[model samples]
Target: MSPTVHEIRNAIRAATGRFEREFEASFTKEELQAICEALKITVDGAGRPSTTRMRQQIRAQVGIAESLETADDSTFRKAELQAIADGIEASSDQ
Candidate 1:
């Protein structure tokens, strides 16, 4: 089975030094908000803070480069490929 989100979060946390505070990939909305407040990052004009925008801003402030993982789309099953395509199209429509 694929790893759970909590498992992924735990694995990332384990990779960091014992006392080091590297930003995590699986922060909840509340946890992310706390991080932003601690970092003194003000939100852009908005009703609610976007977790995605907050993550980008935090990564930028902390000098962490966001890396994109590339993979062969040909390796994915048709249903999986369709889901990915659907997600891309939906996001593009926004």
Candidate 2:
């Protein structure tokens, strides 16, 4: 089965927390743009994308990627994905 919306939201929250910790201060517009490119996500114009948008997009991309990988691995179940998401959320809460 596919991941539930709750699982996806939890994953995104966890990812946002990690991004916050990693950046500490903030990421430059250039750096955010670079990340967008590396993630194969398109930004509309030359103008910088908001940090919030970048974070959301990155989290979604990551979540999708993880889901796809899990789908391919027979041993990985829906409950496993939830557990992983829960773990990430728990770690970030610290």
Q: Which has the greatest TM-score?
A: 1
Q: Write the per-residue lDDT of candidate 1 for residues 16-65, one digit (tens) a residue.
A: 21122344344556655555564567877666577777666555444343
lDDT of each: 0.43, 0.46
Q: Judged by lDDT, which candidate is best? A: 2
Q: Give the lowest summed-lDDT range of ten residues in model 2.
A: 67-76
lDDT of 2 at 44: 64
Give the clashing residue pairs of candidate 1, or none.
none
The per-residue C-alpha lDDT of model 2 at residue 64 equals: 38
- The segments of candidate 2 whose C-alpha lies over 4 angstroms from its true place after superposition are 1-25, 64-94
RMSD of each: 14.4, 11.3
The TM-score of candidate 2 is 0.38
For model 1, give the 10-residue run with minimal summed lDDT: 85-94
